[model samples]
Target: MDHKAKHILIVGGGYVGLYTGLRLQRALRRELKSGSVRITVIDPQSYMTYQPFLPEAAAGNLSPRHVVTPLRRVLSKVRIRNGKVTKVHHANRSVTFEPNAGPSEEIEYDVIVMAAGSISRTLPIPGLADAAIGFKSVGEAIALRNRVLALLDRADSTDDEEVRRRALTFVVVGAGFAGVEALAELEDMARDAVKYYDRLSEKDLRWVLVEASDRILPEVGPEMGRWTLEELRERGIEVKMKTLLKSCEGGHVVLSDGDAFESATIVWTAGVKPSPVVNAGDLPLDERGRIMTTTKLTVSGTNGAFAAGDVAGVPDVTNPGQYCAPNAQHAVRQAKVLADNIVRHLQDRPLREYRHKYAGSVAGLGLHKGVANVYGVKLHGLPAWFMHRTYHLSRVPTVNRKVRVVADWTLALFFKRETVSLGEIESPRDDFRAAAATG
Candidate 1:
């Protein structure tokens, strides 16, 4: 193989893209030194968010910026492109992309890595696209923290009882990890925030969690899942099982079980589908629109093309006849092996297959409350909450972020979590625009 310059293009800047680029940067030392290899990372966002910390961040337990790692700062050697890949032609090793603010252009590469992550899989319920908020991004988490506190303020100031009731009632759909943790954290924050308002007592506020499945946290096993359900119910959270959100038109929430109520806030955390990137490319995709890959992490039946993480349906060696589950743990581990395989391919060496045994799951249910099932050992309450924090603390991207997260927790030990909501952050320029128009 000629040692001429070889360009490798990575699509998406999420967990898989970021980790794979970083690994390549480390592994291709000689190639990089000789200027024989060039790596470019493309994504809509310039930063990678640590998704597990989003719940804590939403609860004001951590700063929003601390949860995101800037791609340029971390991937120094790799070129960072802030854009979306509009189309991929793997047969020709070329991609057409549109930058954040520019015309679409095409680029050819020697190798292509598809790391486009998933997005919220939503139903076409009435008023959902306009009213309900998703719990996936940093913006959503920060907005939620502000919105939750603002709801309390609205309830306390309203004279109409119906208005107060609507403002105080919060509905969360989906009971998976994202849904459960988000509901728990916000519930905890609201419980703590209400104490300051004399007009808003604990009884005045209502929290509802709706799950389509028979139970929540299926990864934690039925025993722990039931325990979590009971624990959530014991905290006065209305856990509606085997129910679906019919609609949230104008904050009037309707459920599948013939229940209807008025809620000012409805958080959607149900599930995610493969990002549209899979559809943008010509690669072979599963019925669900996920790129199909072999156990070795290469795009099925294609050379010089690879994929991993939420967007790729990589055959699961441990489970057999099934693909790997989409989660941070799997994405991270798969990225390491994917990076190694890419380097091996370039070096004309054999690639290693990727396999991982399930390590169990952990979840935080409000302060000092959680559930975990590690290696078949089920734990509940404070111990599980501690494990939830400890495990994620270790996995969070950089050391700087880890320290900031720990500091947030340490300060919480002494000082209270800041409940003040500058909801104006959402529309900081609104006042200025109004003033300018009046002037």
Candidate 2:
């Protein structure tokens, strides 16, 4: 391979792709300036979302725009392409991407970094595709917030008992961090929003949390998880354990535990699987369809091809016989190691193994309420809530975004959360198109 000018193609622009490109832009600064190497990042979106803040965004505590970082602005030296890689011909050292407004194009590279991340893991539940919404992106978070507030408006304006009950009941499936936090935050928001309605009381709103697993928040340990369940139940939120969402047709939800309910909002946060990019080419994938990578973050038995983050099944060096769990904490740290290893590989230097200990987790139940188990220390209530804010604020990516998020929080201290829902934003051209057709 010629060492004159190398092209490093980074696929996906989420946690792994964006962070890896940022680190590479700095580590290869001299090489980039001297025209010895060039980096290109490709993704469908122009920005990388900080997913940890999705729940707060949904609950109206944070602005939706502030939780995401623009990639082109963050990595100025690295070329940015807003498109989707439809195919990867690794052996030919080339990839095909379909641009947003142009025909599909192909580009060849000297090195490839596959960090396409994951998508919402869905099931074949009846009416799921049409009735349920997945909680993954900032758009979904904002849409959910709007939907929740819109439901409140619907309930307050309605006179029929059935219509009001259906509009006020909210259902959330899954018991992981995403589902738990989303449910807790929205429940708190709804309870607060009710205070402004003369006809609606807290009892008028029904919140249901259905989990297929035996317990919720498995990441925070059994003790904390149990306590969280009790707390939510104390707030009148139904905690249905060992239950499954059998069907949700026309806003009628049927659960496995012989319970039936009507709800206008259903949020699905079951889990995530590797992105479709995992099968973009003939890459070796594990049972879960993740690209198989060695502990060094290199594709097994392949040269000049590497992968990390949720899309790659990277063996955990800290754990004897397990692969790293797909999470932001792992993805952020893995990118640094992955970028360093890629640079070492280019420079013909010995690569170092990636390893890190689990640092534990923190979760916010609602405003000024949380639970955290960090490094064997467990905390709850106000202290845990403050820690959750502090930790994520520090890791929100880019100084500007961090500042904006803090400003939002600081402003929240003096003001109330905005409860107005602009559902028309989703269909801005509806009235215009209707009038034009009638004319």
Please give the CA lDDT of all the candidate structures. Answer: 0.92, 0.91
Worst 10 residues of 1 by lDDT: 1-10
Model 2 segments beyond 4 Å from truth? 1-4
User: Candidate 1, which segments miss by more than 4 Å at Cα?
Assistant: 1-3
TM-score of each predicted structure versus truth: 0.98, 0.98
| Most lDDT-accurate candidate | 1
RMSD of 2: 1.5
TM-score (C-alpha) between model 2 and the true structure = 0.98
Which pairs, if any, clash in model 2?
A: none
